[model samples]
Target: MANIVAGIGWHVIGAGMAASFYAPIEKVKKWSWETTWAIAGLFSWILLPIGVSLCLLPSFTGFYASIDPHLLLTIALFGAMWGVGNVSYGLTMRHLGMSLGIGIAIGVTLVVGTLVPPIMDGKASMLFTTRGGLYTMAGVFVALIGVAIVSWAGHKKELQLKGHLEEFNVGLGLLLAVMCGIFSSGMSFALHAALPIQEAAKSVGVNPLYAMLPSYVFIMGGGAVINLAYCFIRLAAVPRLSLREDLRQPGPTLRTNAALAATGGIMWYLQFFFYAWGEANIPASMSYVNWMLHMSIYVLCGGIVGLALGEWAGIRSGLLRLLWVGIIIIIIAANLVGVGMAYSQ
Candidate 1:
């Protein structure tokens, strides 16, 4: 019970970090979106993982050499598909805005990421037959309701702010959101696929919490390949934005933008960092539940971050109240998941 509670706490902090990561990107000036995102990916998807792997698993290379090449390839391939989802996630936010985009994306993600693995593992029946699994399922349903409420409040807030919503491509945005949700779930699949490598990490005296670091190398490598390709493609297409110029000047604007991007990247990575720790503390049989729990808290905390940033400001009192109520429900949902995990244990 205590371990479950602690794991939940770690997830909360990680979620908070993820929810607020984009705030810094808003502060980045004089850089194209492609530039900042790619730079940030350099840190989050490449450097940080390598750095942490080296520090934690000094024999990281040896561990990787010992693992089956097919397994590594498989995990990295899954990550490549997930990279497309990561890219689509950014597009969804661009087309739909944070509130609607995250809400819809996470709702789909919650369903897919949570249930698909169990179904694939042939344990879908356990959700109904097992007490803890059933409770976890209930928590997922509750969190979905919470996401809907928050999205509703956001819609109202949008109406209040703009008098009418901006003319966005609702169909396209929804498509992107759905795609993001489906593909993002590949991440969980990637992690599960790398169990052998994780076990290898364990054999090398790496802490269970950090055992996943080696797998992240291939996973993140796949993402970096896609992201960097997209960024460079955009950079080439856009005559205005030049990596050469940015490098030559290296002024305060460049420095500041780089710093902000780095911060966002690090913040983004922390979500999974603590996710690993949280999962490490839980029993393997129930680990599938971790994705849903993590994402529920992620969206929940994201709502809180939006609130703190005054995203709900200037809305009518009623709508603001709705937003608050929605946040509370998400909190309750997270608690329910924790309790369910404890019960399952």
Candidate 2:
């Protein structure tokens, strides 16, 4: 029971990190989005993953050599899929605008990422076989409902603003949003696929707490390659965008930009760092529920952050009330998952 509580605490920290990971990027100056993102991806996906894994899993480099190479490839491929999903998010924003795009995209991501792995493994039936599994599943579905309510609130808020965005294209946006959700779930798939490697880590005297660390090395390495390639392509094709923006003023400006990206990237990676810790605390049977807990807490935290940032400043009282209702629902959903985890244990 204590372990389950610890796991929920760790998951909350990770989800909060996930919620705020993009804040540093918002402060980055005079760089194209592609450039800042690419730089951030470098620290988030490559530098940090390798460095942290080495600290936690000292044999991480050699650990891969002893495992089936195919397992590594599968994990990396899913990482690439997540990369594609990450990039698609920009397009989703372009077509749908931030409030609507994020609402839809994240909603889809929450559902698909939480549920697909069990269904794929043909263990969906197990969710109904136990009280814990049933509670977890209920929480997952309720989280989705909360997401929908929140999205509706966002839609109302956006409509109350000046007007719909000029570029809004619902048809294309919907399709892209769905695609992004499916592919964004790739991160979960990559981690799920690394189950074998996690077991191997445990057998080789790796501490269970750090066993999942090595998995990030391959997952994000693959993401880094795809993300960088896309950034390079974007830099070449866009007349106004350039990697040169990174060096425009050089000296302090360059250092600041680099620092911002590094901060953002490291913050992003920290989400998984705590997530792995959370997973380490749960029994394998109930571990899959952590993703749902992560997503639920992530959405709830994101909403709280939005409120803190004054994104709700001009909103009508009714809409704000509705948003609060949604937030409360998400909080309840996350607790339900935690209770489910404790019960299962």
Q: Output the number of the lDDT-best candidate.
A: 2
| Global Cα lDDT for candidate 1 | 0.74
lDDT of candidate 1 at residue 104, scale 0 to 100:
63
Instruction: Tell me the tens digit of each residue's lDDT in model 2 across 192-256.
Output: 79999888878888799878888888998887878899989989999988787557766888889
Model 2 whole-model lDDT (C-alpha atoms): 0.76
TM-score of each model, in listed order: 0.83, 0.83
Superposition-based RMSD of candidate 1 using all C-alpha atoms, in angstroms: 3.5
Query: Could you tally the backbone clashes for each prediction?
Result: 0, 0
Model 1: per-residue Cα lDDT over 255-332, one tens digit each:
888899899889988988988888887676666457546766667666666666655556688886776676666556
